[model samples]
Target: MALKTSCPCCGKPFSAPEDYAGKKVNCPKCDHRFVLKTREQALQEAADLEAEKLRQLEDRRRIELIEREERKHRDRRASMPYYEKFQTGTRPVRNYDPRSGPGFLNLRYLADLLLIGAYAVLMLALAGLGLTVYLKFAGVISSIVILSIVLIGWILVGGVLFLLLKYLAELALLMASLGDQQNDVVRLLLDLRDNTDVDSPEQG
Candidate 1:
């Protein structure tokens, strides 16, 4: 017996042997080979293709959402001021540039310089006090008293010197970075007085 069927590839109606109902065949009109699927198998394949298309669409949506979030983060970062991004002690000191325009003075740098100057004055005062103590008590006081005074004076001087050295180290870093830091106290104070008017954006 012959079976009536249509070629899916060429859309040509043709007759096939009944035994060819669920087999592969070639379309004579288009010379295209295809599987002659049963009605149930064809339905299952169409359902599977639709499911795959849905999965692909969902994946694309998720990727688009991720890209949108990334763009928002970039915009937020771009909107922030240059100064807000820098943290103290995180930046490495750079070489001083003489030609670079005098930058604004940093309040923190001025405070460090003040502390160093105070320590220097304290050292001078301590020296004078030690000299007075030695001259006044050298002849009448016991040897132990003289030794104790010397020891105390040396300890105080050592402490002040240690602090002074630390301040000097900090000052060196400030000077090295003065291309960004201010050139002098006057320029620094002037900038401080007019900070709001200064355009301090990061320029390329």
Candidate 2:
């Protein structure tokens, strides 16, 4: 006797022997091949497959939402006025070009490092010279007093120099990052210009 079953590939009803279980067969509509299974096993497999499909759809929807938010941010940046964009540090407003040299050879950053290093060397040299001169010319108590004053002045100078260097270094880093982003934007624009069809503006 022939048993009735639906072809998994084409969804067409057909009759086959019960002994056909676990045997490969081809569907008539789509010509897809699959192994035969009991009705209960097929039902369970279908349920699991549908659940997986729904999970993948939900993941794709979440990714689309994230991409939309990023696009909005880029559009907002592109729409800002020149002055406002410059003030916000989003514009490429640097006086020096960063792409011409190695990381340490960038002139602006090098200048800041030199200023900090000069201050440090000067402070150390002055402290050492003053302490030695005082100890030689005066008593230990007098030398100690003079050295204390020198140390305090050194600290004040160091603190001021540090603050200035820190500000300049931060500005340099911000300019470098902004310049890189601007370069990327320009490259993307160039690619669009080259690839887009001029005859059909609406397609772009």
Candidate 3:
């Protein structure tokens, strides 16, 4: 009679002679050598293997659920706006660098120009006042009214001329710098226009 046998390693079925039962046999499929077990022992081993497979499947299912939840959290974060996704503490701080890139003249220079121009205008005004006083004491001007008018006019004209010259110099410098970086200036102008449009409300 033929004995029914199955490989323990690969579970491949094969037929052997009755004398082969309970003897060491090498599995044809897996090449694993083992003593053949009786029907009862084989059934029990298969049951144990099925239980281990179920446990492994449950562990794999648990891992997959955790990974799916993590993926969902990542997707939610990715959907958020840039500002909302990151904390303020993690944001990089930037300091204003005066010499960062090529652009218009420094504002400090314009301030210096204003200060120097104002000082010069004040000195000229003081000189004019002194001259008017000297003329009054010397009897060159007959009326105090005429002296006052002359002094006032001198200071006003001198201050205006200084301011005009300063503005013209600043404008010339600005134009030259803008001409040199024409592309960058154009981009800056476009950005300014866009910002202005965004800020302004549309009229019905």
TM-score, candidate 2, is 0.36
What ranges in model 2 sit over 4 Å off? Answer: 1-147, 200-204
Evaluate all candidate structures by whole-model CA lDDT and list the values in order. Answer: 0.64, 0.65, 0.69
Query: Using TM-score as the measure, which candidate wins?
Result: 2
- Candidate 1: regions farther than 4 A off: 1-19, 83-204
* Candidate 2 lDDT tens digits, 19-108: 777787777667778777766666788799899999999999999999999999889977775434434233444332324343333745
Q: Model 2 misses residue 172 by how many Å?
A: 1.5
Better of 1 and 3 by lDDT: 3
- Tell me, by lDDT, which candidate is best: 3
Model 3 segments beyond 4 Å from truth?
Answer: 1-3, 8-12, 15-21, 25-33, 81-84, 88-204
Clashing pairs in 3: none
